[model samples]
Target: MSEPAAPADTIPHGDPFAIFEDWFAEARVTEPNDPNAMALATATPDGRPSVRMVLLKGHGPDGFVFYTNFESRKGHELAANGHVALLFHWKSLRRQIRIEGPISEVTPAEADAYFASRHPESRLGSAASDQSRPLENRQVYLDRVAAVRALYPDGNVPRPAHWSGYCVRPEAIEFWHDREFRLHERRRFVQSADGGWTSTMLYP
Candidate 1:
């Protein structure tokens, strides 16, 4: 059996980004599956909310990044409303992180680089997909994929103008750690006006 985690108080009081890096490093070793998977929450202009899972392609003090079809439902929502939230839950560690921020599109160069790095099959699928659109049948989608594959026989699919990435500039980040007896520990960090972070502990 695995050993229990140290007390929450042991978590250092320092830069939240630094703390995040440490936790993420540990998660990479312990998680059984996609350790970078995160839940992205986006809302429509009218306040209607929706969420789906996405992989974290990059992160740092600047923000977290993820790629998707620009015409997808989430993409449309993001264009209409920049504000969003993200959640990272690591079951193996009994911990989760919540981030709220405003998103901006990544540079075209960045998008092209990441797109080029994708597996040939994945590139073809993304290039062929009309994300968030209704499909008449599975065969129709498969046929589209085949057509794309035929056009780019070498699988050097170009990144579509509508396919790109977004970076979330976090304004708030909260860390939650579960403990025995239902006693949890929570810490929230919010960006200040001067571009620095301020944090506080919450009763959990």
Candidate 2:
């Protein structure tokens, strides 16, 4: 199915965060799968880069938030290189958001709260899985989960110290929308010294 036609007003002016919220709300209704899914790009100190899909667990004026095991590959890269990028592509809406920023860890209390809110089985899996690490066999992981279950029979898995979240404090935000005849639309905003954003458009 084709996306709805994007008129001139498709890309709004003013705060990019507000614009993101509006589009995300639409995506929640239109997207068939995880609408909050986004591509996270991180790089090592040597400049080698890696990209992965992660859920947008939280977002607001502070910036976009996603959780992971701090010992994971992406986490290590983020620690080595604070600069990062994020992309949100809602195919059903034919809209995308590109964000560039430096990351900061979410408070431990916040991580614990989010962890506790997850389903019991999900908590168990997250607690047991050694993310971004090689495993010998599938049963190895299953056994770990079983062990955790045995220890926490009530399924009250405590959030691992390494499992936490990071927030991207965006320095730039670009919004893209698909248009007919292959004439797309793009609007970018760069943060100013006073914390306000200066806007501009790019040929697309």
lDDT of 1 by residue, 1-204 (tens): 988876657455679899889889999999999999999999999999999999999999999999999899998999999999999999999999999999999999999999999999999999999999999999999999999999998889999999999999999999998877878888999999999989999998
At residue 150, candidate 1 shows an lDDT of 97
Where does model 1 exceed 4 Å of error?
Answer: 1-8
lDDT of 1: 0.94
As a whole number from 0 to 100, the lDDT of residue 39 in candidate 2 is: 99
Go through the candidates in order and give each one's C-alpha lDDT. 0.94, 0.93
TM-scores for all candidates: the values are 0.95, 0.95
**For model 2, the run of ten residues with the poorest summed lDDT:** 4-13
